[model samples]
Target: MYHAESFAAMGWETYIVGYKGAKLIPSLLQVPHVRELYLPQPPAFIANLPRLLFLLWAPYKILFQALTVLSTLLGELPYAPEFILVQNPPSIPTLALVQLCARLTGSKLVIDWHNLGYSILALRLGASNPVVGLAKMFEKTFGRKAYAHLFVTHAMKGVLVRDWKLLGIKAVLHDRPPSHFHACEPTEIHDLFSRLDLRPAGEDFLPPSSPPLSTPFTRLRDLPPSSLSPAFAATLPDRREDRPALVVSSTSWTADEDFAVLLNAMAFYEKRARAVNSPPKENPQKGDKHDRLPKMLVIVTGKGPLREKFTQDIDECQKLWQWVRCVPMWLEAADYPLLLGSADLGVSLHLSSSKLDLPMKIVDMFGCGLPVCALGFDCLSELVGEGNGRVFKDAGGLAAECETVLKGFPHAPELEKLKQGLVLQKSPTAGEKWNTWAEEWDRVVKPIVTHRPGVE
Candidate 1:
């Protein structure tokens, strides 16, 4: 699946060789310029056995079938490929054969590492499992031999570059592309709300008074049609031409999201405004003084094991929502934009784990024209810069920076910059990046291509 997206975007003549003739049809080979190699299904008598037992035997059966593929490739495929991109998990023997073929054909070998196969094995089996050691050995050997490696995160890169020291292996990193969002327009937002049956709001966080158009407002509410709907967008405070809101939103938890830092910063700003005797946004007392602050909304979108890990701090936020005004765990992604667009700031948070690749939603935030407050994690810092977003040092230091963003929120300035740069449609650039990398790939593989003979 990773290859289908990355290789095709890079303009490679990609092919997927696998079994299942009729069953694999379009779904298996739909990517551009990609072809599939398939084999006939087993006889009906063999197919009707208990599912689990068959599933257990699947790998061995696939190993046997792979031998046939090897013979067919050697005899039928007219030319040897310049590179062989193979994934693990199907059949070890088949992958070993593919590796052998790459060596014999002198094609540069590449491994699309999705995760630590050995680590997963250890989790499923006991730590003392003999197979775990063997699996690690195999992975290490493959990592050493592969001409280049592709990992989804910097954590993976650190393993290869820092730990494995696999010099010359071009570690290409990637994340899932942004969900397809039509260009945002006022009417698009309106149409979205209408489709969802959400009425325009006057001034409240809750949906409009009318019954919703959509029943289960789960992931759909995160889409433009629902989020940008006239009702929701209308509720946002009128934009201030001089200063913009600095909103920070994420699906990551408090520990990962660095919510405490943001809260502290907001408090600091509020205190500073009071010290200067700034007038409050609302009714002020004889002694009461408050700054007419840019409203900030920190939206946390996803939940589960990651959220549970930070229960203490999360509870604090839940309690502090009255003062901090945070919206944790939105029903949909569109809900975030609807909440964030009117918001003066946008923040995306991710764990600073060496294993995490990059957060995909951060790109979505950029696409929404919200300048980011991103964690200075591996690829994320490089992926987004001063222009597109601000990467913080860590969760601890994020509060001071959050305060800075609030004080100098580029509500209007940044909006103009986003419109000028068209940063929202940032994803299509990945396709372009892939194309450039493909050209580099050709250069990297050309020497091997010239040395190898056509398969006979």
Candidate 2:
């Protein structure tokens, strides 16, 4: 969507042909020169087959997707585009089919390499798995000879080039948050929470077999439909001072992110929080129930395959937790950025499938001027090189970092230091600060997109 938006803004007649069921924003749908074309989704009975059956049906699924993609590319477009820009790592049928489409249509293929698809498959099946070996071969066979290649990290570029002996115009285009991710002022924060007052939408977030996960967060609410819906009064941290330290995290509830690490860390923090010396002990008669450390309200946003299981775990764990509360809620497109901007801190559990890639979540957090404590991986230093965030190896290490950084909670000096570092992390364009998604996109990708392939 970001790439298509950028292309449309640059006056390209862009079309985002994706599978149906993808929840795209209305703004993207209504963009001037951009169009949406969706491929039909398979029946739920076929799509939701058990793991073994799903594997057995993989070949058919791939064939169906390939045919649809080719049809969309060849028949659905208003006219043949000069370039067919595609993202990699969904490299199975999409890459191979797109390659074939590019050849048939006589268009240039520009592949944005996010990560190696084989490495991601390897995360589920071991590295030595035969399926993984075949996928690597598949990706390598079709990954070469692009018109221009854009990568999220320089490390990914270097490794793929060396291994696959790729020949193309290669560039590293680091992910940058768009303009909407800026920090909110106190008044803006209050207004956002006020407008986003919670409502019950059990059908969206609850399991059909079970009663709505009586937990606070599973009830997903709509923004536009309920924008004027009578504001049912629910517990909202409307006042910034009165609220616990608001921590935000997002996930897709997938194996790539080990949410268990975060759960364990929060459990440790909960125990420590309970053991803290409180003013209530000293002033029992006055009934001042205050502690040196502030309570933490961590709200995780995003819905995915693994969400149901993880939410259940949080539900079980929160029963024993007092000082720390972990709530999993899916926010609407408009409200997501607002919550990120209003958050006191951000946490990332994104473990890259290929260690060469970086997480865009932290970039979004940095865009919101929210300090982060990210789960460590090999390429994390690339993003955290400026000391804008801290990295931890495991649950214990993450717990230690949380205790170290958020010691004073709402008035945490260490967190403030990190936020300040994020503010100072800027780029100079003609000696002026110009560090936004649009500018950076123009700086790196625009040149490649416009350059003649014949040019040296």
Candidate 1 per-residue lDDT over residues 147-190, each given as its tens digit = 65666555666666666666445554454333332234433433
Error of 1 at 298 (Å): 2.5
After superposing candidate 1 on the true structure, give the runs of residues whose Cα lies further than 4 Å from its correct spot.
Answer: 6-109, 113-139, 151-183, 190-248, 251-291, 308-316, 319-323, 330-345, 355-358, 377-381, 394-397, 406-456
Clashes of each: 22, 0
Clashing residue pairs found in predicted model 2: none
lDDT of 1 at 392: 75
Summarize candidate 2's per-residue lDDT along 1-456 as a digit string, tens digits. 888888888988999888765467645666788888998775556555665686678788888878888888899998888889999878988889888888988898999998889988787667997888999999999998888888888789888889888878888888888877889865466556545533322223222321121222222223454445466533222233434677889887777999899899989888877776343566656522333566777888898878888888888887766677777888877778788898888899989998888888888888888889998888788787435888888998887777777777666788888887777775352222327788778878787778743322
